[model samples]
Target: LGYANKTQLESLVRYDLSPVLTNPGLIPLLEKEAAKQKKRVKITLKCETGTHRQGLLLEEIPEYTTLLKKTSFLTLEGLSTHFANIEDTSDHSYARKQITLFKEFLHRFEKAGLPPQRNHIACSAATILFPDTHYQMVRTGISSYGYWSSKETYLSFRAHTSKELNLEPVLTWKTRIGQIKDVGPDAYIGYGCTYRTNQPTRLAILPVGYYDGFDRKLSNSGHVLIHGKRAPVRGRVCMNMIIVDITHIPGCRLNDEVILLGRSGDERLTADDMASLAGTINYEVLSRINPLIPRRIVP
Candidate 1:
């Protein structure tokens, strides 16, 4: 609702894109736009279960519902809430309480005699961890990219259930080796001269760096796959380039495929691997990839 300007509100009315109502203040604006377009706008109320992010409180439901009742073109399509802690830990006590509160919110809507069609609360973690959270529909993400919500979520699932979800990575961040050069023994590589060769080394300069979300911390620590071989990153990661020691991978030339995060034969560089090196999470590594980078959908 924060980004819902006049143009966006009109777009909602013009298109059948169901939107979530986080704040009741935006209700009138949406209603006004819907009235102008003579369109039935589907709205899902995001209730404050426990996350305390963007959601309406229980006490505030009455006025919001009443206001919705006044808006003839506005239809309450769903009642949803986000889990506060479902993936980070093996414990789901807080998430259970959130589910309870969400149920109360659903009952509140039902008592008001305006039951929503789509009663959903499950995010990627919630959908994976708790089955009961799956009401009318499920919103599965990360898993769609063939990755687990988290290691904790995976452990919790394995501890409680026997089902094994065979999740193979579907994403592959690829770049071409922009340039390759040979460095004599003890020669420095890249900025700050962080890496010096012990012997003659062949380097593959990749067109990516921290600016490309190839984290700066990966300098001299991370490895990329080239010619199905592990090539160690050399020196400090630059704004738009990183030098990798590719001497071991023979017969590699300029524009050869470089795997920033993916597999090459038996070698794989995953977002999880990168995160471990960067002292962050896989989600951050995946999400921080520069949006301007062109993505190719492999069939």
Candidate 2:
């Protein structure tokens, strides 16, 4: 209700009623309105499949199922859960359990004659790995932007089937070199003097840093593409700048395009690559980008 505007509110009302009054805390207020209007209204209970970062637990499934069944005001429109790591075939225990619990949920609801029209359990990964679990429509996010469910998952799927649809990355992340300098051999670069060159070097400073969500942990370990070649990031990224060893790339100058998280000519830096360096994932790399940076949507 807080985030939903008039259009969304009306849309919710048109599709289902219980969602409007499922909270026991809101029951009294809803009842008062119903009393005043002399009508009865049904509601639907909405549950998070699981925390995005955390894997879904089978133990928690029954509690939510019971909650939905017990709510008098809520008319069950659907029962659903998420398979966070279904794409990762290396481990099947987690994905298998989630699927088992969802099947149990479907059985119980069907026996109760309240089987949900939408029994969604598959995300993009699940859709690719477990097609049979698609009881209803799939809820896709990353793939909608033309990215794979995950790198590991994509490889597995490709090995299994050659008839997959081609997907293209839709976003480009680029920035210009803010400054340039030539440093003598053994000169330290950036904060904490984390980088020391053995030979004379030319460095280009980029106006992006941890404060800009460039990730401080990437210092000295990450690479950015410039002039169609990979350049190592030097030292620690500061609030508004990063230093890169551009000595190998001749004719590099201030304001030249530096590919921090995108393709530059033939060289490319993917979100997954960045996340791997940061001990995270591709989702974190893209989502963690600060909102202050201007984003231009391309056709």
Candidate 3:
């Protein structure tokens, strides 16, 4: 909402959605748009506590507070900030510093009689690690998908509480065996001759590849689930194709459902596993999936 243009801001107001305003420049624009629409626009002001990504600085907030108070249709309904060091580690000294700065900003707002009704700074990590950051609302990200924010966040949660917090992953990436073929011994597979068959081998050609968000780094080092069994990636991951060794997986055929990153019978291939094998994070593994692919929602 902070970077929203005139048209977007108008649309948000029309849709009855409050936008988060970060830039002071957007304040006047929103006022004009809301006045034109004759609609009351409740906007959340993003205060730059410590992230330094968006929001007004402490010096800038006083002036903006004056400007925001002058608007007839635009109301500062919420105040928000983001924690810079809330994730990725257990040390939270910097996050605490940011919260202290936020409290100072809140104090000023209260004195100015422009106190926002909502104050939010909790991302997924903050929601789990620090209960105090949950003022009015929480902006959860990775945890919504039933995935932990990070190993450290999970560890911190485990160390603090004996209660169980079960978060099952809801997303599953699936593909089908496009073709199956037998290869002679010493035959090279895929581009660059990266994988050579030492013995007579059976391979399953998959229609998905790095282009579809199946990471290219999974080449040779990664495995997939087929018939509830593991199939090792046979060669370099291509733009639109990947080959997996299905020699041991019996009763395999073309168009057999393959689990790229999901449960298959009693077995599962998680984004966390893919992240580790690809030398990346679970978020990247899930977000990197190509958007062109059709997504289906199931219970």
**Number of the top lDDT candidate:** 3
Model 2 lDDT at residue 110 = 68
- Tens digits of per-residue lDDT for model 3, 178-244: 9999999999999999999999999999999999999999999899999899999998999999999
Best-first order by TM-score = 1, 3, 2
Model 1: pairs clashing at backbone N, Cα or C within 3 Å: none
Poorly placed runs, candidate 1 (over 4 Å): 1-7
Clashing pairs in 3: none
Give each model a TM-score.
0.95, 0.76, 0.94
Q: What TM-score does structure 2 among the candidates reach? A: 0.76
How much does candidate 1 score in TM-score?
0.95
Per residue, candidate 2 scores C-alpha lDDT tens digits across 1-299 of 11222334344444444442223344344444444555544543333333243222344545445555544444556655656666656565778776776676666666656666665666777777667877766777677766787776788677768876677667778899889999998999988898899999999999898887888889999988888999999999898889999989998987888888778888888877888899987777888888989999876
Root mean square deviation (Cα) for candidate 3: 1.6
Per-residue lDDT of 263 in model 2? 83
Q: Candidate 1, which ten residues in sequence have the lowest lDDT sum?
A: 1-10
Best of the two (2, 3) by TM-score: 3
Local distance difference test scores for all models: 0.87, 0.70, 0.88
Q: Against the true structure, candidate 3 has what lDDT? A: 0.88
List candidate 3 stretches off by more than 4 Å.
Answer: none
Q: What are the clash counts of all predictions, listed in order? A: 0, 7, 0
